[model samples]
Target: MRLFLAAIFISLAVGFVNACSPADKAALLAFKAALNEPYLKIFDSWKPSSTKCCSDFYGVSCDPTTGRVADIILRGESEDPIFEKAGRSGYMTGSLSPALCKLDRLSTLIVADWKAISGEIPACIPSSLPKLRILDLAGNQISGKIPADIGSLGRLTVLNLADNRISGCIPASIVNLGSLMHLDLNNNQLTGAIPSDIGKLTMMSRALLSKNQLTGSIPVSFSNIYRLADLDLSMNKLSGLIPGQFGSMRVLSTLNLDSNQFYGNIPSSLLSSSGLNVLNTSRNNLEGELPDVFGPETYFSVLDLSYNKFKGPIPKSLSSVRYIGHLDLSYNHLCGTIPIGEPFEHLGASSFANNDCLCGSPLRTC
Candidate 1:
């Protein structure tokens, strides 16, 4: 089945999840009914081989030892969500129930994208499900401050609440989700400064707080999230120097800080990210030399450093990146002879557009 369970790839000890008790299996059955979408034909759409338990039901994955549902994927074997067929859309809007806390053994709950769900998130989310590891509630019309209580779900690994109408400042308590690995709260109506201690989520691999109303300096502690893989905070009201520690995230792959009020040179550390693939910091007050390695086949594949006050020779060693596809370095004070080489030849002239003195292969003359 193409039903990939990305959240299942965790660092949990193998021995711990190998066994499940019968009682746990029963809890899982009841939890299924408690989960949202009671009217949806998903669980009831087809009669499973066994009626006693929904363990082998569609979108359900059970612990092999205990025969209890460990994961719930609402998609069918055909790789299609039951309700989202080509010519049809669902409109079974209703309130979410607090009874979902019964699924004590569940590690992931991904019901956010369903267009039919509306109403407040279950406040009992944190207190009831101690073992909950992943909670995705994106692309919903969910209203209300995020239940501040979710901070208690220490075992949570991924919390995605993006594209919602959620308001209120991100509570300071959110920093307490110690084991959180991915937090996506983009495109919301959230207000207030990016919390200072937000960097405390050391286990975070991806964080997206863009397209909101947040205002403040990028936190220094942000660099402390060594496990961080993606950080996007664009189109906000942030000001001040981009945090130098941003380069400290050794595992960082994507860094976007565009459309902000940042000043000063981007820390060279960010330029040297070994695992970085995408780097975008356009439309800011940045100054100084851009990394000398943003050329052809460097570590990053897609880079956008346009619309900044950067002044310096373009880095000449960028011909190393063979996988580069998109490069936008226009609208800067850059001055240099673009290397008329294989890697540079493959890139578009827009990459060197609006530069004061950029010349070479991307252009006909200097």
Candidate 2:
């Protein structure tokens, strides 16, 4: 009977040792103590009584082999059953704990959309979390500059800090993220020119940096990002000629440079590219005749060139395009009869309105 009791005691002791380590547990507790998630009680599961933090803790996951915490995904906007049960979204108000940097094994840390979670992002994250692959703290009230050493995370794939109050110039070291794929710093208070070598992120597919105080001409190196599909530099103070090299990008389809200070003619190669479907250069200082490079292969879903200084008649070549779902050429110095073709049949006078002397079936007769 004594032998049996000893065996059972040994088994229990081993199980306890295999559970979350003491240091990790302490770090997690400190991390939780900083935040208050009142509605869903998400932290209720993160209790000292539940020793197996790997399986028992909410929004926390650990490696099966090492029992080390690997991920902490807590989003305020989730369709989790907890949100459904509460009939509302998650809401947490507090600062992120620096203790999170203690979880050295953490691979993904996403505490996003917690509207009131305000504080500067812990600067030690990039150095402490070497295994981090995804760092999405977007849609929070987090303020401060992005970590300068963010490029140290060699395996990072997604870095989204959008819809926040983050300020300061984008760190030049950001272009060193060789594995970064999706970079979103949209709707932030970011200022200054984008990193000149941003195209060095060869694996990047979408680069969204709109609605900031960014200035400087579009980088000529942007054409080097062969995989980049969507590029939005809108609502900024950027100026200079839109690079003609942009027309050569093999996969770039959506290019938005609107509401800026760009000057010079629209590149003909941009209109000639068969892959580009959405091009908006509105509210800029761009002038010159519309590029007469449209062909049967041209297919633009949205072509907005309004509110510019473009002069000259509407390009007759535009009529040869396969499709142009939405075309806006208003508020320019364009004059002459609107080109009559299948592409222009559905367009209304508003498209050609406010032009210097434009006249056609849509507008008053010439």
Q: Which candidate's lDDT is highest? A: 2
lDDT of 1: 0.73
Per-residue lDDT over 239-294 for candidate 1, one digit per residue giving the tens place of the 0 to 100 score: 99987676666688899999989998888777766667888999999999877654
Q: What is the lDDT of residue 59 in candidate 1?
A: 60
Which portions of model 2 miss their true places by more than 4 Å?
1-18
Model 2 poorest 10 in a row by lDDT: 13-22
* Number of the predicted model whose TM-score against the real structure is largest: 2
Candidate 1 TM-score to native: 0.76
How many clashes show up in model 2? 0
Q: What CA root-mean-square deviation does each model show from the true structure?
A: 8.3, 3.2
Which ten-residue region of model 1 has the weakest summed lDDT?
A: 10-19
CA shift at 89, candidate 1, in angstroms? 6.5
Off by over 4 Å in 1: 1-40, 43-78, 81-92, 101-106, 291-297, 317-324
lDDT for model 2, please: 0.91
For model 1, what is the error of residue 183's alpha carbon versus the real structure, in angstroms, after optimal superposition? 1.5
TM per candidate: 0.76, 0.94
